[model samples]
Target: MVAVGAMGVAPAAEPNTQVPAGSRHYAASDFPDRIVASPAQDAATGFAVAWRTSTLSAPPLLELALAGDSPDMGRLRQITANSRILQSENGTSQHHRADIDGLQPDTLYAYRVQGQGTWSAWNHFRTAGAAGQPLTLLYFGDTQNKNLSHVSRVIRQGWQTAPDARLALFAGDLVSGGDGMDDSEWGEWFAAGGWLLPGMAVAPAAGNHEYFEEFEDTPQERRVLGGHWPVSFALPGNGAVATANTTYWFDYQGVRVAVLDGTSALDLGTAQAQAQWLDGVLADNQQPWSIVVVHQPLYPLRAERDTSVLATQIRPVLQRHHVDLVLQGHDHTYGRRADDNAALPQYISSVAGPKQYRLSPQARATMEPVAEDTQLFQVLHIDGKQLRYEARTATGRLYDAFQISRDGKGRKQFTELREGRIAPRDCPRPVSPKGRDDRCWE
Candidate 1:
């Protein structure tokens, strides 16, 4: 077991026994780890590559080529990456980033990173096609499991369901152990994704767990942005400066995906700025379908939770723009709700880990079908004016499914795609206040 700070750096230790094969540890290395591709200015014509190298390694460079039908990767185009030094429990390392523009839309490309003589395995990614093209995306919420393998299984199952999903959207709480700064946990996360990463773009929203600060009396136990949030993945920089790395938006085909930092907006006093920016983005969005991914659900599943501030600050913007879907994760339960006042965008929350939380009556009343103590994944398909959504258990059990269609008049009609097959699962009420019992008693 590895001991890490609540946030930020932990005391230096030996390489974690948990590090999986093919994943990079935090220690200095000639090869890169956490190699990923993120949306740049435009999904079709621009993309950014980011990775990490050990402090012992030199600045890295990216080699890219248009993947062709033949196995031979033709001529390589080289791009110099900018390096930033970062310190973690594994010691110091360099984070490298490079943004490429003017790539052909809907084209396949292969890329690899090299620091010193060691190079990363080549990864291939397909660019988004023109607007109105059909697309599939996978969404997961709060995958902070006690053991990363539990979350890994869910992710692999999701890809098995939609192997060609263009993008994976994470609604925060990616890893709660050590506030995401734990290098070993990140290695597990990267290893779990396996080849999917770098091959497919990742869009992550920052959850409360992603934020931490040093205590006035305990500087060594500093907590801040987890050790990896800003460095592990290179997300789009088109967000409010105050919430730069976590807040961003990108378009794939005709769908517009906006990632908001719910924790920062609520705790750091950046709500107004984010709200204003969100309004502007949604107001001007011309995309046929829009989706918002945030850490905390506006309509929380827990009774003790109150997201009125978030609703007041952000919900109006979503309603005004007629967003198609709002995906959230935080409450460790599965739920979907359609606002009575507004119905264009359905609000949903899901957990893809072993963690489970009791769903409140208020949450149960809004959702037609909900689940507890079940790891789940959501697959979304968008084609023309129609959007399809399906929620399934980690092992591939269909739970809830629905479809939304926009008519010529811009009116939206929804249909329950699955009727009798839906099996709603909820844990039994705890017999005692301790809440340690995992079973129900008659």
Candidate 2:
């Protein structure tokens, strides 16, 4: 396990412990969970892609083809792409990816891999266009523990309900990483989503659980999660840890999504380093919607207002650049503080996992976009100059919804502010699953 300081990481390990019926042979031809799409390097013309393979081998190299049977694509020429190999720590195996470039703006493309002498079934993804336009994206709080058991149900439900969802963002604490690679936890994380992640665009923000313990001699921080994240999903490579390869940023359609490592920024001595880079990234990237993702919420659900560490550190930069949205997870409850800035703003804090999520008495009394121990996700629809954001639980219930419309450059408006709170709820209090405890959920 790699040490992530205060933040926890989801450890990667072999299935020696958690295979159903102990079927290790099934590893062949099987793909691990955390499969999702990310925008490739070229903000204007490319999108990067990655997915996990059960048995390790050389990375899959291949070209792309649009999967849909649209008349427009029939006449379009097929594009060739290059694939790269990545290794996972669970075992030296293949984590495949292709940087599909030269794609048409706002157009959809499908692709497959050619490696180990086998051609993978064609997979599909969409590209983002340049310029000012309202855009849509998906946000999930945390999928850390209870991955397949509950997380799978939540993710599949979200996909089933919103098939058109172009992208998915995570708030972190995605898996409950124990002292080392707890095979059961990692397996649950992947099995939860099964193959759904590959079909949707998945963008992740590093939660503490996403880190792993690495040896002290190792310079790149933790290697546990380092082994899992790279090939599990394909992401653009313009982030803070350019040389390290973990933190990076990308642009989708007209939104510039910058993923910052909160765990590092807080204690890794990368504060000044990343802060400097962020200043430039925010200043240089001029996308219509600027979104930042990190594990710890700047506006914590239960922390003291003045003591909220991250908010004090990054909120100024966000306000200065007029960032449109800030997404986060950690405090395991649903919360939203609209227009938080002294002037105007939109801040949201939510959770999507099944562990340690609860609504405090104080939190419940305040009301205001509150839900207890709820598995929820946010769906936003952007068209032209309008942005509509809705918060919904895993059961497909609309808990809270609102709209923030922009007229043009530097113009903002708020609409339909829903007041009140969802009934309070809590996860079964933590208890050893090995022993009978009411807190443990079977």
Question: Per-model C-alpha lDDT, please?
Answer: 0.79, 0.63
Window of ten residues with lowest summed lDDT in model 2 = 433-442
Question: What TM-score would candidate 1 get against the native?
Answer: 0.89
As a whole number from 0 to 100, the lDDT of residue 81 in candidate 2 is 34
Residue lDDT tens for model 1, 1-442:
5556789554331222355545445465777778878876479887888888876344567989998778788898898888888776667778888888889999999999987678898888889998778899899888765435577888889999999798889888876655334666666677777777788878888888776665736746443566578877777788877888788888888888889989887767777789888887777787788899999999999768877788889988888888889999989888988865966679999988666777888989888778887889999988778898999898888898899998877678888777644567878556322345532211
User: In model 1, which runs have C-alpha deviations exceeding 4 angstroms?
Assistant: 1-28, 179-181, 216-223, 428-442
Per-candidate TM-score against the hidden true structure: 0.89, 0.79
Q: Between which residue pairs do clashes occur in model 1?
A: 28-54, 29-54, 212-223, 213-223
- Please provide, for model 2 over 221-317, each residue's C-alpha lDDT reduced to its tens digit, 9 standing for 90 to 100: 4534544555566777677763245567777766777787777666555655666677777898766567788777675666442224566667777
TM-score of predicted model 2? 0.79
